[model samples]
Target: MHDALLSALSTVNDPELHRDLVSLGMIERAELLSGVAHVKVNLTTPACPLKGRIEADVRAAVLEVPGVQDVQVTFGATVRQAAQPALPGVKHVVLIGSGKGGVGKSSVAVNLAASLARDGARVGLLDADVYGPSVAHMMGQGAARVTANEQRKMQPIEAHGLRFLSMANLSPAGQALVWRGPMLHSAIQQFIKDAAWGELDYLIVDLPPGTGDVQLSLTQTVQVTGAVIVTTPQDVALIDAARAIDMFRKASVPVLGIVENMSYFVAPDTGHTYDLFGRGGSRKLGEQYPLLGEVPLNVEVRQDADQGIPAVLAHPETAAAQALIQVARNLAGQVSVRALSQSLADLPDQLTVV
Candidate 1:
């Protein structure tokens, strides 16, 4: 019965991953008794949007097996962690930040990480937004826990081809974190030093809005490659964006560029564009820095995020997803340029005979 059940389950696949659950190590156990089969499916995160679909698929597959009169599908999650490194092997650490709240900084961070992973780059996202970590929900791991390995190092959870660590995974859902500056600093430090990030091409840090303890802790903890400031095309957002830029400059972290999210909204019925938040605000800010790219205000982006699948992965053909991909490409190019420049700077000078 177990063999038949396992074989049946092999036919069921994760919709997002497009791979058989058995092969993906999602099926934890399958047992049968008195013509009834009980199956346990372990997901990467607890808040998986496709949980119903996955359960239905598994049940349908199991019911097809001979002698399986009843099928009971159970769900659980085991969030994995990486081993701690003496020195992080990440090539570049990009901080996604905003000066004020409600500017969609976390959304950009999640999509940027997804986009980079889609482009075949090894990416990791760290949600340093301790007060309100949204990466877990956005990535569908809201109920996932961060477990430590035998070495006492925290392991990052994996989703959408990216390894991520977030405060949401550490705390229960809707739990408020009340910590002072020193405590906040220690938590951020542990996230950087104790989490096993492995070797990553890019580790995207999603910082909480504003230039606060987390930002200071990150700068003091790790050598950030640069910062990607996110802002809407509005004066209020732009004002805070400037403060964020100044914060990065004061910390000596390069401002890679600025991304103008919610630049405009397009009517689906009439195919008309509306600059709901006003226009050229990011370009105005671009006078002092590079304008990385603009992401349109699209409903699909929000829906995909709620579904725990980033737009870049869920609907790559869409305009919004493509815009994000372009931003990722531009960001990668900037990183490459900086890396090459640093490599040259590290080289010993060769004296020439006069």
Candidate 2:
């Protein structure tokens, strides 16, 4: 009966990774308890958006086995760590950037990180924008102070169930950080190296605009998982986005995808939609990258940001919040595909049929 269950489970594949769970080693254990089938499954990431589909498919597959009166399915997740040794206990590091400011890049980063953390992933947010650090304020920790742990490493501030570190917390309010290139580089390096970031599935770095010193220093310091570019539908923003994409390409870092922010707006009273930025700006990228999502303009998002609550958590049913969740899911899917692709490539000469 156990062997039959294995054979049936082999036909069920991960909807996003497009690989059989059994072959991918996602099935931790499978057995028969009298007339019931008990199965344990491990997901690649806690932020997997398709777990429901996977579960339903798994149950359907197990029922095909004879002598199984009922099926009991249980799930757990273990994120795969990269080969990089930069952040000791971090599994993946994702940089959220844009070509210019005022495009809601920070909001996107905050909400995405929050969404992933809500999905049970151990998440950390690092505000790498020294000159204009707003992650602290957006996270409702503007008055919070940074402290050192017993090991003398800077500790991350806990807020809304997410661990975050920011220069805004490290420095005083209304203080201007006039840092030169070398200073900026050193600060970035310390943020990546000197912080006491415990075990985490994803560390999201909200980077400043443009392709400058901080970006260079970060690439030199560690092996990043990839980068997500945020832009509006405006021509100028798209042009700058082109340069940013080229910069990442020159540095040999994969450009995961692009995010279109403020794509459109709908009047709450009249329920009429308006293309506030423009139309089809992402389509101009010429199929070079995936359009992660189009986040609509909503007054509620701004209100939520000020209140230090991410849209995905504060207003999950809103259009803006749903769009942000989609972006997080898409980003997670891409990371899983890349991580599992290497594992698939390194498969042994002989197959191990469980």
Candidate 3:
């Protein structure tokens, strides 16, 4: 009976990871008592959305065994950490920022990471928005707990083919973060120096709105590759976005490009286009820096974000997703070009023969 129960449980798999629970070390123990089987399952995170589904699958599978009149399923979580060496193998770190709040910076960062992953790049997302961390909920790992490895480094939570770390994952939900400048600086340092982010082709950082201590601390702490400023195609947003560009310039970090989000909206019923926020704002900003791309205002983007899935993955055929993909490609191309230029410049000039 126990063998049958184990086999039955083996058939259940984690929906996201697509691996059987038994092999992943999720099934802790199982026993039969008084015609009722008691089982314990361990999860990767507390905030896993598929908990109910996993529980149902386990219960139903166990009941199929002979002599099992009832089944008792319990769940526990043990979050594991990855190794964090001093020299993390991340090729490029891109910071995504906005001048003001509610400009969809986090959404852009998430979709950019997803798009890069889709293009076969190993990506990592760092939610640097301490005051308003949203990556945990956006990536569907809000209830997930982070654990430390033997080296005592916090492991990034994995989701949507990207490894992510966020303040929301560390603290309790709805808790106010009243941290001062020094505390915020220390936290940012810890996130960069102590977190186990392994090897990644790109590390996308979602900065908190405005040029605050967190942004300053990050620029001072790490050698950022560049920054992408996100803004709506409105006067207020563009004004703030200009400040963001200036902030990156002062920090000596290159402004990779400007992404004009919510550029326009198209009526689904009438198929009519509307410049809801006005147009050509990003193009004007592009005169100072490259314009990565403009993303149209779409309801599906909001729906996907709320559902904890990136639009590119949730609705690949949508215009918003394709626009994001083009941005990713352009960003990747820029990074490559800059790397090559730097490499060439670093080469020692050959001695001229007289």
Cα misplacement distance, residue 112 of candidate 2 (Å): 0.8
List the RMSD of every prediction in angstroms: 15.4, 1.8, 16.3
Candidate 3 lDDT for residue 98: 96
lDDT of candidate model 3 versus the reference: 0.83
Give each model's whole-structure lDDT.
0.83, 0.88, 0.83
Comparing 2 and 3 by lDDT, which wins?
A: 2
User: What TM-score do all the candidates reach, one by one?
Assistant: 0.73, 0.95, 0.73
lDDT string, candidate 2, 1-354, tens digits: 767888898899899777788888889889999888999899888878788899999999999888888889999998877656338888888989888888899999999999999888899999998899999998999999989999988899998778999999988899999889999988988888888999988999999999899888888888888999999999999999988899999988888889999999989999999998896797677399888889999999999999988889999999999999988988887777766777786765332465
Candidate 2 regions off by >4 Å? 348-354
Which candidate number has the best TM-score? 2
Candidate 3 lDDT over residue span 128-152, tens digit each: 9999999988898999988898899
Poorly placed runs, candidate 1 (over 4 Å): 1-86, 344-354
Ranking by TM-score: 2, 3, 1
Q: Which residue ranges in model 3 land beyond 4 Å of their true spot?
A: 1-87, 345-354
